[model samples]
Target: MSTPAPEDCGYPSPRPRLSVEELPAAENTQPIRSLEDLAAGTFESDQELEEFLAFTCAERRRDVA
Candidate 1:
């Protein structure tokens, strides 16, 4: 038994965006092992990163406060 989604959920229905056969093969799509590795990339601008950090920090504050 599953709940019905609202008619106006304001989002598309959850469906596969891509089929497994249609996906590209990944040669080196792996997780970074250390903070140093992540720090090596160049960001186009700091605004996007700053906004994400601020949003996450606010979420943590709300959870704890």
Candidate 2:
């Protein structure tokens, strides 16, 4: 018997950019453990969505830098 190719199984055949060793992790950074972290919230309008996106982007930029 023969095994199917990655494309046949719905996976990309090319090698990914990063190996497991290259993954980002440290004592300060950890996976999300709380259910509330994945909670679904909504914005009432486009302006509100833009504001939320801008705020979150700035916060993440500061965090990663």
Q: In candidate 1, residue 38 scores what lDDT?
A: 73
Lowest lDDT 10-mer window, candidate 1?
Answer: 21-30
- Clashing residue pairs in candidate 2 are none
lDDT of 1 by residue, 1-65 (tens): 97668545766677656655455433334557878867845655799779888999999999998
1-65 in candidate 2: lDDT tens per residue? Answer: 99999899999898657655555543345568899877667877889999999999999999998
Give one clash count per candidate, in the order shown.
0, 0
TM-score of each: 0.35, 0.36
TM-score of 1: 0.35
- True-structure RMSD, every candidate: 8.5, 15.2
Cα lDDT of all candidates, in order?
A: 0.70, 0.80
